[model samples]
Target chain A: MSMLPRRVEFHEEGPREGFQMEKGTYPLDDRLALIDALAASGLRQVQCASFVSPRAVPQMADSPELFARLRKRPGTRYTGLWLNESGFERARACDNIDIDGKVVFYVTEPFSQRNNNCSVAENRERQLAWIDRYIALGIPFEQAYVVTAFGCNLGGPVPVSAVTDVVRWLVDACADRRIRFPAFYLADTMGWANPEEIKRRIGAVRELVPQARIGLHLHDTRGVGGANVYAAMQMGVDLFDSSVAGLGGCPFAGHKHGGAAGNICTEDMAFMCEEMGVDTGLDLEQLVEAARLAERIIGRPLNGRLMRSGTLAAMRC
Target chain B: MSMLPRRVEFHEEGPREGFQMEKGTYPLDDRLALIDALAASGLRQVQCASFVSPRAVPQMADSPELFARLRKRPGTRYTGLWLNESGFERARACDNIDIDGKVVFYVTEPFSQRNNNCSVAENRERQLAWIDRYIALGIPFEQAYVVTAFGCNLGGPVPVSAVTDVVRWLVDACADRRIRFPAFYLADTMGWANPEEIKRRIGAVRELVPQARIGLHLHDTRGVGGANVYAAMQMGVDLFDSSVAGLGGCPFAGHKHGGAAGNICTEDMAFMCEEMGVDTGLDLEQLVEAARLAERIIGRPLNGRLMRSGTLAAMRC
Candidate 1:
């Protein structure tokens, strides 16, 4: 058997997942520019924004407005995560020339309580209620994502049994023949995963949610993001969630505003995939340009070494 | 098979290897204090200093004097390394209680010429001559060390035959005399070794010199020091050379000093060994004290994160 992965797919996380927690006030024009650059790189899907309470996440205040302005590519799917009825309504009211009739919803219990001032039970009820709204609107459920399947900040180590129960909720949401099964995604909000961990939990996810398309959204805290991705990929995970110039972080992770501290740089991810004989479709040069643009917009170095040092090894003289 | 190594040992590398290449002048008293601090940590063996030409390694100019001043501790065999007859003679002249009949002659070849400013042939002639002198002075030859048996900077990937040839020269010097054969220590002078490289070369060494006690002295130039030590330890290597605070770097390698720059922290090695279940007989608290002392002497924090963070895991709760 080959040690290398056989195939690869890419996702651009810059617009929504990358800057959702960023304290720096980014203009919508700059956000659009970053998205345009990333979309130009040929990434198929993006975790665009969260339709959550603006008072809770002011950084995502203009989430709907920003999505309204994007000149999205034909094949690219923009996924906006929602938690409650109000946020889903706000996402549904957004004006877009070209858009799909699917909506993604996630229930981050420990985080929803902290960030949304609701109990875990309330958050779960609200998310299930939103799925009912999705069925009422006749939107397809195959495009929706149930994120943070791994664990949460306040609740540590999401047991595979817990995830198994959560997938049951998704399966029920698609019952009654109104919607297809919701797509699944695992989000490591606190970025604490080793390769063995990925193997254990992701292997469980594969067993439980075998038919659902899964994407892994990882944080690079503790220097294990890329290795975790490599592990997941080895276990047959095809889709990945990453930010250009290594964006995104938790507001409360203490010491350096999250960003997984040393996050998995997308350019580095591209390099890792290519080196391991996997194709990411996104060109390296384009990704580098996207990183440079994001860095200028974010007003800091992305803290990725491969971008600083050229990707290819220097030829021996 | 275990995903982690079946067995692993970490070599404390900060004091001996780190202090030797540093540019700042350290007083002999300070050097003694540093060595004492390192020894207090209970590290099995440290590669004290090379007794080569003072002009070539001016940093170790007072090695003989330092040997004289060492506060001898019982069961702690004070070891000294020599590169030639002149060095061994100088070391032998010292009548200190610390190293009366226990000084080990260390002469490495190939890259040894660049380090000692003498050809391999000249080094062999001198080493053979000094072995006789050591016998005459009644110093034990068991403490003697032949370094760089793996590969060299000046001469790449040293053939196994070259190390065997050097051992044969040692055999000829013995003249059928009965004494313990000198330990062979492989050195990564320029740090080009990978795990595979170490595994292959170590196999070759054990194949030829099965009876010779083998040790590894590695520098972390390419971030493989920990991996290499882990590999060697798994292969049954017990003896390794380390410095307190990870203070040294090969001047022949890249620049950028300080704890974060190059050398692997001695505490990291200590931590690795302990976690991997290998008993290195090291005192963690004492090593931390010693590491901080080494850092103060160098006017910089040495590369030991464990010292600052404390070796034990702190409770998040």
Candidate 2:
């Protein structure tokens, strides 16, 4: 109980994650509306778009237009994701998007090849080059993402040692360049993590990088996402990456059975945190409204519980 | 970690809970097929029907016939829910249904009046009468359920003391009759419980009855159902009542907003337990099949995750 954080931070990734996986084209206006709604909901960070190829992700092809038109909230940090130098350059070109340097490494080579179209060594070299460019441009590093940190659908179960090894590598990479590693985000890219696995993996990462600010990017694909969030919070890991209305699914995850579910829902996670006496710094009603907006934009019922059932505060009133 | 249970018992409430809430009539064959599938899935206890009025719950009108035609599996305990003497008599008339005497008390008056069609006192008197009848018949007592034990939609937040008072009353009532009080099941009837609330309320209950086994009947209405389950498990509370394919919303919970979600999904919960090394004595594959069958019967996508994403073991294979 003592280990639970009194406050937690959530990064909204619905615009980037959700739309990218959706089947049809949504108007740029609808996307912007959802993003603005999320920013107004008091989320400190909002990943509004991804600078990926239109051919790869047709929905995110309007990334530059989204950034150009987005009404940026003063307190909220608007961010975008990019996987390579070309994507990074595209993100750098956006005036409204916050250009924070971040690096990514895959825990499994199979996922790395499938998602990034590169070998593990090739991806690392690309990341290192980006790190050098960031240093040269005086851009402060945001975090290092360890994708498939828990387990991979293509690569099977991930060992705690494998997670620790990734963290250790990222730490040493930053140390060698005299740059302090800002944070480490462990991503359950394929929704393979359970609550126990979450605790074990986080503990293992902490053991390797004792002072690193650890965060989670968990998928609710398997339905234990809320449990996983609670487990992480119990360990005082306050940072999380979530989607509004649980918008996105992993396009890379084997969707032959059904498409993978999205990240732990934002309003649902925020509602849980606030209910448990953890300060989420977000408005529940506003988040719910945003979730509803997301649902309307998607033109379907997204996998979010709080959006459907609402908050306890609303119920009490 | 040491407080976590090595094994947990799940009472399948899908057939009884799901059908009673669904709108439209389902064929007797479809209902029996689901119940039979659940029984064959290694579930020890399956609540197959509710012997309630056809006017109130048209879906459960076939409960008696359901019991008569159900293929009774040797190891499974086929059960039915009955609120009053008439319903009890209907259940007693069924040759195949297992009859274990159970009592219920409401934590709040408004919900008591609304759901049970009586005040708390009147409901208690009815339960007492049923208890006497059970004793006369030499029927074994199962457990007592504390409805809206966490909070109520109409009655607002329920205090910890309110729950313990009901438990204390039930304990004393049984003691006065010289019958030992069976287990206490704290039900989050309207999905009002958060993880912290679960821990706090369970702790309060344990203080009053340290020797008694405690169980949870949690709703995933607000999305913290999985988290609440984890919190209870950490306290070594092993018994749970879950719905297959996340079936059955509370018809009583205000549906003016979107209707309340169903119970914490059985396959999802079981998947979490199994992945965390908690023995459930149920087959994951069989449960997935059952969940799909539930979706097909309902003619809609049920709110279950494992049924879509699949188990980690399947991914490993």
Candidate 3:
């Protein structure tokens, strides 16, 4: 068997990424209810919302209000996504939310411009400039999100060297400022990566940052999402980002942008792990219930298969 | 990276298996049209229909008529499924249908009785009695299918020894009879398999039948269908049975009986193989078109993801 970790950490991104892709904005109470249900499902971390512009992503306009209403579960981490200074300020002002203060950099120039309205070079310069203010707000600028780390929509293949260079730069900057980063995420933003590409890129990232935990945010766009996860597990990657019921997509890119389907289904991922003897510290049944609730809240069938089929454990029971 | 095969053979079983699961019996002309489209999409082999009892499976009652009207594609192999002597005789009467004379022995007794209406020992005895007759008719008994090789709905956990014993019996019987059996398939009829289970079972089968090619016929009951494929591929097992649009379930067990979701989707499987540089020699776009046609014919949406999300290759193009 390929080498694998005995345990995996699945961080739920449904309340944030899954909701943001919806064409209709769910009621605030409904959204809060879904998050509470997810928290009860034994997930250690939940990405609650993104504090982006309401004009850009209307679905996330209520992030501050939602954060205030969030009943934070003990021993559970609740984080909010922040892209700009305004978003970070709003996140910092929230009562029950934790901010990652991640400086996002796209691996390709076209995706950086198309998705973020900035070039790769300009985004890097801007992020470096914001480090002092972000640090002053008691937010750590240690970790980074290498968006399109595998490939991009406009430019097909994002070079492995480019991703590693960004990681190395982050490491050097952190060392210069004496900041510690626990982990970094390689986001397959467009869901274009294969197992070979995953191995290549994850290997490169590990070589650059030997001490930091590596995570993968995979998409099921091409139907290889689970296969890609298996390959990453074989490579000893234990951190994954998934959304309930397989919800989420890029608003700028649209549903079909870069063939993005949704984030890997959280229930599906947890099912895979539990079946393979990898403890995820989750209740599969509760996750399935949460997924069903998510479907009701969204008023559409989610992309996940386990909800329809049921788990083997459940069947045996 | 884990060791993998350079090429994989994906046999399309959608028309046969996918259609049989639907509540609606698709018109013969529509079934023929979907099969023709699938053949044109570069799939080398397609299982067109099963010649089962009309009373048992009404959806497959038109097997004879469908086989008669099929537009045979040059260089493509078309096969039919048979369970008893009558079904085998019907397949032989057809012009283009190929029969495996597969003598099935379920790993668990309850599944054998529930699915095939015969106990494991009785089925084995009956199949052994028909071997001479099957060979005399020039229908090679070259392969067998071990139904519920992974687990059974009624019997729960099937032992690894039960599966290997069956394979060893086949190997010995074939060697004694001077017959060359090319392969045997391990069917996860209930889809109760994980990567670990796949590794364990496929490893045991290989150790016993050193020269025989091993194949996996996986279902998507618990959503690890793609993950199971990846695990098998890492173990150097490449042959898979997939239905277009992921349409299939054991009618005897029903959709919820054994946690049956559907078959491993053909388009989704082809997409995964293509993304990982494993050649399946199939046009994904044509497969997607076939899936759409299937959905229309069935008057319901199929379970495939690639149809909704499109392929990464198409996205790149």
Candidate 4:
């Protein structure tokens, strides 16, 4: 079997997922600057912000305001995170966002209770309701990110069946709403995935819903983020969620030992794909500069290595 | 092609290369303690120390004394670094070392001049002289590490022919000395190798000398260390040189942007192999603890991720 794919695409989450975990709230100007930097770096999809309750996620309290102020860059796709009707309406109110329906549903009880303050079954019902509401509003669903699809911190050992069960249910819900071309993401919320586990889970999801577009939202908590991506690519996966400077992991994402800091570094992932002869269509040198800008904004070094030591291609160039 | 090997082996260099770049000299007791910890951690090949001059590498100044004090463990092989005949003589004087010859030669002019303070030709001549001295002493020559086999920081690009030339010269020299079964290592000294470079060089070496055993000494500076290892394994390489807690970078290894910290983390390498269903014959948990101890001794966090985020096997165990 081929060890890699010919091409890959990434959704930049630095402004949304990356900023969510920071201790201090970045000024709206800095957030817009990061989004602009990502746009200039050739990232097609940028998850700009989450319209979550400001009280729960104080870091993103100004999501709507930031979205209002962000100068939409041409040729760039912008989206926002939404978990409920209120969040969806907030995202819809913004002119900057090009995509509206972004939903996160927990696959396990412990994670649902811990992060959402609800049980898994309740979260599933709420997700269905939101899907119907989104369809009623004529908004095409972007992606239904299945949070903690691999495993959870409090609810450990999430079986493959549990994950596929959620996917199958989501498919049924989408059909009920007459929504076609559904896309789902397997989010390793805690970064608790190995290559075998990634292959097994992705295989199970494919077997159950072959028609659904699948993507991975991986965390580098265990440092296997790249390996897991390679494994997924070998199984024909190409779409992924990453953050520049590898920024952000919800404070809750911290393990008993160390924080699974940030999503897989965007530049690192792009560099890996580029090195494997996979076309990423990203300006990696610019991405590295963006990561540096992020570090300057955060006033501390982030967890990305590529920003520090550049790509071989860039070095040779 | 299969993405991995069935069995992979690692030569631990935390005690040697890891310490060489540290700012303060670790007291002899601390050094001995780390070695003992490594010995107990089930590493088969532990690179103990370098016999370089104290004036140059004060961290390794007490190599002979430390070697004399080590309680050698059975089932574990010990080795030391030797850049020339004088360093080889010092290693020869030690009773702890199992493999008799260890040599590092540069394949690029920039690295040879910058690192060794000599031209590539001069370094090659000295390597041959050292090999003759080793053969005269009846010491079996082990691995001839081809530094900058992939690319160099100062030297923009190292052609595959440069790598194959050095490997071919080392093979012919061994034959002329009546030495058999020579081993060669493709060292990405500046971490300048990508997956393609690794494949091209290793493929070239295999075509030129199919009988020669090949290994990789990779650096994770570019975050592709694991990817490079996977790429090499797909081409049939199973032996690697790594440092515990991913330590070392030859104070010269740091770039203007970031310090290129050490080799691939030993536990990360083992974890990747183990996750892919390959047997590393290592006690990964013990190795992680050894890394922790190294961190404690260094009084700072090391570059390893597995130590911070426990491995899947260890977590399950």
Candidate 5:
């Protein structure tokens, strides 16, 4: 359909992406309220909550209840990211079965292995085992989407050929499954990817998976994240993964500058899209309001500017 | 000469552009020593110090002595800026034929009114008067120029037509004098020009001032300074005015987000030049050392990245 309508996928990782990062516990409702607004912002897909254990991401202790209170939007899909067998089973048992018409699962390779006490192989195998459960429940099992596919910051710049290899590996691994060929997504797990790197690797991915969808999950750690989106778009990569108001990151990865930082904010993405003539059917004013809610949920100001200043044009009006 | 060089020339603004904005007065030796490092970095034309009154520019009170201490390079020309009639008088007395070489006079119209209590036309009248006197005194008045010719922040954006009109007015007012076509430079008095604007105005200036030596004076309030430099250089505008470690603007301007908080750092501009294969012939390590000295004089960390991060290839090595 016109190469899959230029759509924006809001990945609300605040539960897993945001809370796992904070030194303090964000009350459950604080996150739920934010998720409710995010869903209303016309975002199609969201990593609503993760099914990891409390000890690992103690801030996400209430993933089950967090899902229970979620106000599912029509045409929206909720993905419960799992790092291991237990997280998958826990996610399966959670109160919502339909997931408002869509379901998917994701895990980062080395991060999953280290965080969940399992190898990348073990994590993939366990996640594959849960696909049938999703299929049997009459739900769409969005192929096993992998995260941190770009490179780990701790490990250094990932080779472009290595990224292409990951896409082929995922596609081949799921070749026999009933689910569609698993899509490959790249995440700047530590916000390290700049414009040049984005172009080089995005080109590598296209070469490896010409028919498959490629999503970019960029972080604004170096201030090049937004610009990287523009660069990737120039290279014909459109689908991107974003968090609202930049409300989330892996706390253990590092701080914002030298340490781990938040992903490029959804509103900022929408703003960038608006500027570049890409349409995501989002209400920017409403989206900004949603971002403000997210900032309050985490009790910290966000890194995004579009939310704070709105568009420069809007301010003049 | 052929066209404005797309490769922007970066001017280190530490001693003149940076410190003139500093509220606290720096010692003559501290200022001179800081400039020594900048000089070694191969900046051919440095705004070494201002020839304004001590009451007006206390930080630059000893411009003459500061010039005396500078280790003059063969190709380098140290320019001590002058703001008004009184400044030109001071410029003649401070002209050190042996060390500083020549005396150049310039002033900002908007700032002269705001800071010096004179109208722009009045200031120009004063400049025309002084250019003749400098000629009469046999001091090379040919090197003198003006700033804030394009637009001003507090004065707001001037119509390009108006700017051209002013240039024609300034040029026509010079009676086509041999030195009448002194370098016509554009300044971002409040750091407001974007990349697109830089391209539009600077390109327009190239067309209008076809034979006048053109240069750019930028303040990096917005983060788009580097990109703007790329745009300006691509348009063939060669000469640029920058501050070492991005020291620039009125200190009061730094208190605002859109003020002249940062000047284009000479080191960063050099890096851009190196990447783009332009010949700047700057010694970056010495520039970094210059940045450090500027930081110490200001008693705060300077914000230019090149001064802190070593060579681009150096890290990869």
Candidate 6:
């Protein structure tokens, strides 16, 4: 009756996601220190920065320098986020940053325009062009992200058909190019997912592409991120993208208040997975230390709970 | 395969739980305002105060005055917490406070001594005396709370047997007195529950007393509180005790940091339930306003998400 996975993979996104949304400008050394701490905590992949316009996201303007100065850990992949071809080129220019060909499509048009300044159809065409370039550059296709897969803040209550349509499009595009279909990541960009909605969406996507591995990019914007993760795991989803200390919020999400939560906390999710007898391969103590360091660097309290409560392992000790 | 209840009941404990854990002394009017706001938000039961030793919880020393000046909302039951006969007497003396006899036992000995200042065995004896008093006073017995039902910070992981033992004791005690067995509320006094553990423990308790209703009093100390609530709902748990704006942390739980979270946020949980199509008989906008009011009174941002992110219903409109 239990559909839980035996192991779960987490991609840490605190540095890129957390800092970009923050109003204050942090020192480049502080950013690198946070990423280094995350990598040292045994996170296999740490999203170090976002390669976007400096005028738009002033906090992430030092993406290239951050990767250049990062103390890379063995067995860890340093990654970055890029929305357009130019941003992708910026990431590819950095030798230390991991470059894998990835495509993204928005589930809703309003979000697509606001987040990427392009229509959904236009974004699809852009992804096709990127696919051709990836094939030519010998870069392995990593995954396609379906942003706002659950529901959009600008456009409410996304239909499951909309999500499946994007997945179907990705499948057809890969097939047309004679390339294998990569994994798919369903992103709840605005924290609009409930547990049942998570299950329904995952089931729908799985029904369409049974062979593709599905990952979740959830936000705790409305306090159900952990439940959404649990729901996905019950459907055997093993991949997650989380932020350390629950650090990042999307500045474009149109939240009225300053306290909009970021992605589900990395150490909190890892703690949940490990406590349920699932192997996360991350040290709780190290992650706790990283979370605390992140809080100290930010000079404010972050939304993470494990950093404050201490791990149950410590209590057992 | 979905076992979620069609309608869920929530008992708001913000005024008692949130304010007691808060360090600053709030005005009595502010406390009454919060309770009134919670009741107006369509919460059926609001726990306004705790009748404990003033020396122990100075914040709640004005419980009697709080009840006296409370603007009673029709069809809403204003309740208060009491752990002993003296506390019970104080609550009984308040004409406006809804008095229902409740019993509590600790799953772990260490938590029992620290939280209630008595051993588990001594607490059981005290509960027996309280039961006799309830019978003598012709008061209706409401429920029995199994504190630290999941795990204890001081005593480590609690066995499922430890939980069932308390449930069995409660059932037997009611049977001995020829009274109907009351509902059992499992309190995660320390935030140690995971989703799998929630299912396993709820299943174990149900097997022992199939007819008795079960409620959960959870803390979001280390996150996963929402997931635990969802897991319990999958087993058809309809009753929950929550704090508004996620206010309140146990002063005795030994959290090193000041940012320890309280009970799961009432508005956030209600938002989750409503979004999932479960009727919670509460207005989301009203609850959100109440949560904001709580934040203002606490003079800090509370750990709720919906108050910041707004609601899907508003977006759809």
Docking class of 3: medium
CAPRI classification of candidate 2: medium
- List model 2 lDDT by residue over B73-179, tens digit each: 98899999998789999999998989988988887889888888899889888888888889999997768899889888889988888888888888888889998
Q: Which runs of model 5 end up more than 4 angstroms from their true locations?
A: A1-317, B1-8, B22-33, B40-42, B71-77, B95-158, B164-175, B178-185, B207-215, B236-239, B249-260, B265-280, B283-302, B305-315
Model 6 lDDT per residue over B229-308, tens place: 99999999999999998988654455676566789999999999998999999989999989999989988778988898
**Candidate 2 clashing pairs, residues 3+ apart or interchain:** none
Q: Please identify which of the two predictions, 3 or 4, would achieve the higher TM-score against the true structure.
A: 3
Off by over 4 Å in 6: A250-255, B250-254
Look at candidate 3 and give me any clashing residue pairs.
B18-B247
- The CAPRI class of candidate 5 is incorrect
lDDT of 4 by residue, B1-317 (tens): 26567899998989998888887888888888888888787888898898898898899888888888889889788778766658777877887777557577787776678778999889888888877776777777777888877777677788878887887787778777778746789888777777666777888989988977799998887677776787687788999999988887543444767676569889887877776788998888888888888888887657777777676553333
Candidate lDDT values, in order? 0.61, 0.87, 0.82, 0.80, 0.61, 0.88
Q: After superposition, how far is residue B187 of candidate 3 from its true place, in Å?
A: 0.9
**Residue lDDT tens for model 3, B1-317:** 66789999888898988877766677899999999999988888899998889988899998888888877888678888887779877887887775666666777877778776888888777767767676777777756788888887678888899998887777777777788865788989877888878999999999887778888899887778888998898888889989998888543354442225678999988887887788988888999889888878876556777777666564466
lDDT of 1 by residue, B256-300 (tens): 221213454567666656644556677767887887777778775
Q: Once superposed on the true structure, which residue ranges of model 4 sit more than 4 Å away at CA?
A: A1-3, A117-119, A175-178, A207-212, A250-258, A313-317, B1-3, B117-122, B209-211, B250-254, B313-317
lDDT of 4 by residue, A197-290 (tens): 8888888989888877789998877667776787788778989999998887544444554555678889988988886679988998889989
DockQ of 2: 0.70
**Global Cα lDDT for candidate 1:** 0.61
Report clash pairs, candidate 6: B248-B262
TM-score of each: 0.61, 0.97, 0.95, 0.92, 0.66, 0.97
**lDDT of each residue in A159-184, candidate 1, tens digit only:** 66666666676677667555666556
Q: Which runs in model 2 stand beyond 4 Å of their true positions?
A: A250-257, B250-254
| DockQ scores for all predicted structures | 0.10, 0.70, 0.52, 0.44, 0.11, 0.73
